[model samples]
Target chain A: MAYSDKVLDHYNNPRNVGSLDKADQNVGTGIVGAPECGDVMKLQIKVNDATGIIDEAKFKTFGCGSAIASSSLATEWLKGKTVDEAMAIKNTDIVNELSLPPVKIHCSVLAEDAIKAAINDYKAKGSTRKPAAGVEA
Target chain B: MRYYEALGLEPRLALDAGDLQKRFYDRSRQWHPDRFSTRPAAEQRTALEMTALINDAFRTLRDPAARAEYVLSENGLEASAQRGKDVPADLLEEVLELNMALEEADGAQVARSLGQFESMLAGVDGQLAGLFAAWDAAPSAGRLEPVRAALNRRKYIANLVRDARKTLETARET
Candidate 1:
């Protein structure tokens, strides 16, 4: 099947295709997969400890072109956004952005799930750590 | 759908190849369109439909993995494409590392990884066999969760192995 221009664009020049230090207390990691198609995606975020804003986002995906594109777009949208704003990012918006076919809609769902999982991980860890560098002790 | 019932046999995963073949042929004979040539239109249509269903059931039940999926579907547990998102963190970390090595490896390295992946898949298959037995001993929803989880892991391993094999094939060509 022919891929949409947006999908092809992202696939060829995928954004944020890397990993953060998963062991870092300040970094949140989200690893997701679709067993039916054997697609796995790992997305990570580093959050500003005090401001509650995402400082950086990265992703690595093993799947079809659409899956890769979906995750690439997700990371692009995640960076510099507040956790609440990131949470509001929905799979339907992603589907619309990529013009994903019905069959490939699950790829978008996976992306949204990875974003939420990462944010949740950040929240769980962000609570117990030292405050941001600029924050008062 | 009971694949065994569709073929008029008992529902057992350890079905004998000979018995399965015999049952399939016997069932086919009963639904053969040629035999229905003299029957009315509705009867002929029914025979054709039954024949198709029997063929599909036999094909699925003949393979271990496909048969397991069919059994899962029968128990109202449809395997979703999103099922692997919940794998344990440690396993996910290991798989990610393994994938990275595979992607960067050369011919010899890929060959070595193929062996490792095959062994890993074998271990998963062993686990699946145990789950299958567990399900057979007591076919309940509670037991099926582990079975489904095992199947999800197997799916991941299967894909990794497939990618490794493909890389090896390309290496050979070049």
Candidate 2:
């Protein structure tokens, strides 16, 4: 099947392809998979603690070109944005942007999952570590 | 949905491969997304995707070892990927020998190895069947982890054997 131009473009030149310092307080990492497609994706975000802003994002994915594109686009949307703003990124917007075929909709779902995973990771880790309390030794 | 529900089968341990194959073909002809290509574009697209899912599930369940692995996974257990490092020494030694022979075997030797491996696979499958029956009867969480690990081990070894057979077939064909 022919991939949409956007999918092909992202697949050819993927963006935000790397890993975050998972140790960082504001970092969120998401991992999701669909057994039907045998696809898995990991999305990570580094957020600025004081500002609650996303400073950077990265992702790793194992799947077809459409999955790659959706993730690439997600990270592109995530970077340089506040955590709240990033959370607002919608799967339907991605589906529209990529013009994903109905059969390929799962790719969009994976991307949305990555976004949520990254946010949850950041939240889980960020709230605990940020404002590091002085050790009353 | 339950696996049995997905396959439109009653939950049962033993199944007839020949009879199941006939049912599978009939289902494929009737409900496979490919048959809906001439329908609406949206419906066709849905059909195409569902067809792929059906095919994937069917292929996995049709094979004894793959089915075992999936059953293991359903219980939230996985065999170790670094099994060579993490597995018991005795198991490691056996796997190593099997792998080395598979790696070095000529096409004819590999074909012979495949027959031997099939018998071994059958043994593993029988063990898996017993394990599954036990799990179904008792449904013990305590047993699942270890059982899953063993099943995973079988799956990995089973996959390697299939890979070896494929390589041998390629060599013989060429």
Q: Name the candidate that leads on lDDT.
A: 1
Residues B1-116 of candidate 2 have per-residue lDDT tens digits of: 24545567654434567766675666667677767868998988876766666677678677765665566566555442222223443553355456557777888888888888
Model 1 chain A poorest ten-residue lDDT run: A126-135
**Candidate 2 residues A5-65, lDDT tens each?**
9999999999998777767666777766544434456688987766667888898765679
DockQ of each: 0.63, 0.02
| Per-residue lDDT of candidate 1, residues B110-145 (tens digit) | 999999989989998888788778777777889877
- lDDT at residue B84 of model 2 (Cα atoms): 22
lDDT of 1 at B167: 97
Evaluate model 1 with DockQ and give the value.
0.63
The collision pairs in model 1 are A34-B81
In model 2, the runs with Cα more than 4 Å from the true position are A132-137, B1-13, B16-174
Displacement of residue A24 (Cα, Å) in model 2 is 1.9
Encode model 1's per-residue lDDT on A15-130: one tens digit a residue.
99998998788888898877778788999999876777899999999899999999999999998899899999999999999999999988999899899888888778866778
Fnat for the candidates in order: 0.61, 0.00
